[model samples]
Target: MKGFMLMFMGIGHLYEAFAGVHILQYMYGCSRDDETEQTERFGQLGYNGENFLEYDMKTLTWKSRKQQAHFMQDEWNSDISRLDFWKNYFSQTCIDCLKKQVDKGKSTLMKTVPPSVSLLQKTPFSPVTCHATGFYPRGVTVFWQKDGQDPHEDVENGETLPNDDGTFQKSTHLTVTPEEWKNNKYQCVVQVTGIKEVFIKVLTESEIQTNWEDPAPNIILIIGGVVALLLVVVGVVVGVVIWKKKSKKGFVPASTSDTDSDNSGKGVQKT
Candidate 1:
């Protein structure tokens, strides 16, 4: 049977308004003959909110819950590049439980081709960011893969920036007609120099805009602001200097002493 799989982790107990969420899904888990049956089986095996009881309607396997929670809006993480422990749970469908303890299997998918540009939400056209820092793509290749079937298999429009260490890490920004972004699905793929390809989907503007977790404003704005301020300061300084130069010599520098050379004791000998 054919079906999708997922594992969640790092549910840092926080308010529904603000919190980090993640989910892990792998295709290298198992093979199937019937896609619909597989989907049904997996859906039935899905974690139930009533204390972790995944119900398999076919075989009637009431798998006991082991610390599972209700699948909410922000529950399962969509990023495939997660390496954290709790976020690396094996979530697939099979007769027997498929739980493996691989040291670094958290983002197995991301370890593949380049990250894919996500389906950007288009209320406001957002950017798509991608960083290639995985095992497979140590420096393999980088690009954007739209559909999940293939990496070098879709439309790509943007540039790739290389990392400081000669490796490549790139970001792509595209403004979609408010209608298309929200309605379309996109992804960013990273191809390691020699390894495999790792791909990630572009989710939101925030994801791409702040992909670097950057604390600084955009390069263009920051540069522009600094340049403008410098220009203003220069203008003021120039105005002052021009005024000073253009003005008649000030009656001489101001002094504590009176203008009279008399011994007023203001402390200045009459040269």
Candidate 2:
């Protein structure tokens, strides 16, 4: 990023030397990864160029650089001449200068790393934030969209912030109602030049967290049933058995009946 700023400064200085008017152009801009990009330019004519002007790419408006106010210019011819000069300078001279710098081993092409994207809803009333970080080239776009269209209201946009690792970061938030949240029409879209495809995330139940109970009780019940059955089988196979005896009560003998019959025969003979 420092190298990039210096290069622009060098271009402005070289143009001033060539034009002999001390033309000063201060360009400032930033991007998140490569998705969304913006640039601001404030140019001057001489040392006391406090009345300088600038162009804002996002709003498509021109304003005074020092005062940060918009004004109409009646000097169309003068503006046109300066515009033409800059066009030629960037087209031919800028390219040649950059080539020379590369030949002299003063320019480099750094590899860009893709950003990490996250969609978060902190609270019920709070907005859903789409955050991206750790990207290169400082050019990226993060937006809240519905059905492929940009929402006009209930949206908050954040500035592109720098990270410690030299990558860029940005975030955007959308305040949605419960019906809109579950409608499946809301999505967060991200785009970066280094990445092949756009990154998109949606709000769903699968993204939320929930609590569940432990299964220890079910496991204990299963073990107890098995042990009880084993104890029953062992008792039937190895246990001792006891029997009770019955006593003799009454009996009839054959000698008693023969004696009674002999007594009856002796009584008849005496008669």
> By lDDT, who's the top model here?
2
**Model 1 over residues 152-260: C-alpha lDDT tens digits?**
4223444455546433444444444445545755555554443433455554445643323333557778899999999999999999998988686767774565555
- Tell me the lDDT of model 1 at 234: 99
Per-candidate TM-score against the hidden true structure: 0.25, 0.44
The deviation in Å at residue 268 for candidate 2 is: 84
- Residues 22-140, candidate 2, lDDT per residue (tens digit)? 53445422222222222223332322344455543343334454542233322422477755655554445544554455456533244567888877666555677788888775778
Please report, in order, the local distance difference test score of every candidate based on alpha carbons.
0.42, 0.59
Alpha carbon lDDT at 211, candidate 2:
40
Superposed Cα deviation of residue 152, candidate 2 (Å): 1.5
Instruction: Please give the lDDT score at residue 271 for candidate 1.
Output: 79
- Residue runs of model 2 more than 4 Å from their true location after superposition: 1-45, 50-97, 100-110, 194-196, 208-271
Q: For each candidate, C-alpha RMSD in Å? A: 24.0, 17.6
Q: In model 1, state the lDDT of residue 108.
A: 50
